[model samples]
Target: GRPPEGMWLPETAVDLETLDIMAELGIKFTILAPRQAHKVRKIGQKSWQDVSDGRIDPTTPYRLNLASGRTITLFFYDGPISRALAFEDLLERGENLVARLMSAFSEDRTWPQPVHVATDGETYGHHHSHGDMALAWSFP
Candidate 1:
């Protein structure tokens, strides 16, 4: 089968039906706020008309396999952590921030996954003064 027209929607505010539409069009995966996954009740269910319970699991990613057999993997960003790093003055000093962030996951020593930090691109410029420079200096 041929691929359908590709379109990008900002904010990606989509429901189950929207996902179904995308699946029908052959969309493989999409990044969206975890809130969007709220409507997902058992696996393989469709219809975004249902409301979510407002609880989101951030450890693993969620997948929605459409009738077409094409799977859409959804990753729920850590809204609280991202917002804190962006809006709050938590990570004022880049070195301190990096140390704290690294120390958080390093406690286990056995943990295999690497620790990471993600935030709005503008956070470096708009939120914190010299934030970009701080990040650059803190890294390596």
Candidate 2:
């Protein structure tokens, strides 16, 4: 198995035990689909609030506590945009692909978080031919 940096689950499936495993293994964080999050409340809030359009704030880190009091962070990926990039097959051209990805986060929010776009390695060639080339060409 790879060193415990992070983990990706199939279909983003997870449960308490899985998160506990992540915490025990020293995994720093994991990505989840936006909808997977029931709701989120600030560290001290009494009630969980709905994220915009049910999408979790990707910019902030969410902490989950295990039964043993260990914690793991969850980073919700931008689900709608990710779906567009994947099923939509919008990476026909590398440069445009970058622009499209960037376009998802226009008009700064009060809180800015890292933008994460995850694609399986197989997506580069097996899923879509030339995906690798498009990714490389997008950079200046």
Candidate 3:
């Protein structure tokens, strides 16, 4: 079978060497938290914009330059939204879950966007109490 888009690394697990190796292995993209993203700039821009201290726009994929001049695209997930669901009881109900997910794309996005949200595996059922039911209901 062919490989999917990319792979994910645990929190702060991917460093320069890891990315260099991944690119050598033919990986093209990955998802990281906003904090992991040091800075970003639109394509063809000369300056790097600093957004790592706060939430980054998850709508666009950003490029990272490796030491050898190779690059890999990185998608930063919605940090504030992820935090809400993880610690602030945002997933206590199906409606809350749906609302949180929808708010990310409520704007008029002209280009295709991937609203990626990352969370701990326990978020599905163990941490929030009957969370799987909420997910099932929200999607079903």
Candidate 4:
């Protein structure tokens, strides 16, 4: 009922050309792996802080000014937590999953922070035994 707003690239793959295409198509945002973010900086600022170590603040969405003069927002999901959920034994207990998700936020910050976990679709019912049950328990 509405115009498209976002696009998810296969394998989370991304490049400037793809980004420009998305922007031209009026796509507002996309999710990306934290490692894909090379640098970041405050809006309207000149300096960029390198995220080569893969440590990025997942709380805020960053604006990418593309070469086409169109902008797109990027959200970098938490890599380690996503990996733990998909590969580690996190789904063995729903409580463990909840705890890990909670730890991603900051307690003192007045503003809200996002805990984005991007993982394979098979992670729900195939990757770990009873993972779908664990996910349901975590939410409820």
Candidate 5:
């Protein structure tokens, strides 16, 4: 098998030092919670717009430059949708899951967007009954 290009941090927790270490190790990307992002700016731009309030646009990945002169891509998952799937029983029905997932897309954006949902694996068989089935059905 090929080596991993990304890593998932425990509990989605992160710090700059850890990120720098990951970049040093050749890890190209990692997923994070929306609240983890303090600010963002376009690639190669200097200005960073604040997103510390957890209002980041979760549809696209952002680049984080490390102090070591290395950079890593950060992909923040949709917090509200992930919470809904975990706590609001969105996984109870496949249709509901599909609908909720679809709602994440913005029709106004011309660029491509990805809806990344980071939830516990147990959410399927352990947390919600038949959640595995619902998730599989949603993909089809």
Candidate 6:
């Protein structure tokens, strides 16, 4: 399901009507690229204001509530970290990447919930050579 008002598609190509559509369909939330916010003057300014107010902190997740009382959670990805793993040669070593990720979450002792990594699925065969092998070996 798509998110209401604030849900931004990656490309940010949709229009305001899309929000109406999402609201009609009961979509909760979605993520968008930074550039997407710049398209609409009003919305874009508000987004920037939120960022300035620490409401859009990149290091932590935030929650947005719609007028209908539906809630949507938003997580601004760490662009540098995600880009490093996506494009840097060092990430080819799955062990190194896994260690970094594990370290990032190690402070949390509430165990049992698995850590899920999200990335473009095509990265396995199309972007990085031996990417599939790297993941297979690292995950058991």
Q: Candidate 2 local accuracy as lDDT?
A: 0.77
Q: Which regions in candidate 2 have their CA more than 4 angstroms from the true location?
A: 1-3, 51-53, 110-112
Residue 124 CA displacement from its true place in model 3, Å = 1.7
lDDT of 1 by residue, 108-135 (tens): 4443533334576788868788777767
Residues 23-113 of candidate 4 have per-residue lDDT tens digits of: 9989999989988988999877899899978898888888998887999999989999999998898899999999999999888766779
Candidate 3 clashing pairs, residues 3+ apart or interchain: none
Report RMSD for candidate 2.
2.7
Cα lDDT of candidate 1 equals 0.60
Compared with the true structure, all predictions reach lDDT values of: 0.60, 0.77, 0.83, 0.90, 0.93, 0.52
CA error at residue 140 for candidate 4, angstroms: 2.8
Cα RMSD to the true fold for all candidates = 6.2, 2.7, 1.7, 1.3, 1.1, 7.2
C-alpha lDDT (0 to 100) for residue 108 of candidate 6? 56
Where's the lowest-lDDT run of ten residues in candidate 4? 106-115
Using alpha carbons, what is the TM-score of model 1?
A: 0.59
Question: Poorest 10 consecutive residues of model 6 by lDDT?
Answer: 35-44
Q: Is candidate 2 or candidate 6 better by TM-score?
A: 2
In order of TM-score, best first, we have 5, 4, 3, 2, 1, 6
User: In candidate 5, how many clashes are counted?
Assistant: 0
* Minimal lDDT window, size 10, model 2: 104-113
Q: lDDT tens string, model 3, 1-140?
A: 99766988987378888887888788999888888877788879899888869557888888888998888888888988888878877778999988988888845778778888888989878888888787788888
Instruction: Give all TM-scores, in the order shown.
Output: 0.59, 0.82, 0.89, 0.92, 0.95, 0.54
The prediction achieving the highest lDDT against the true structure is: 5
Measured by TM-score, how close is model 2 to the native structure? 0.82
Better model by lDDT, 1 or 5? 5
Q: Write the per-residue lDDT of candidate 2 for residues 5-33, one digit (tens) a residue.
A: 88998878999898998889889899887
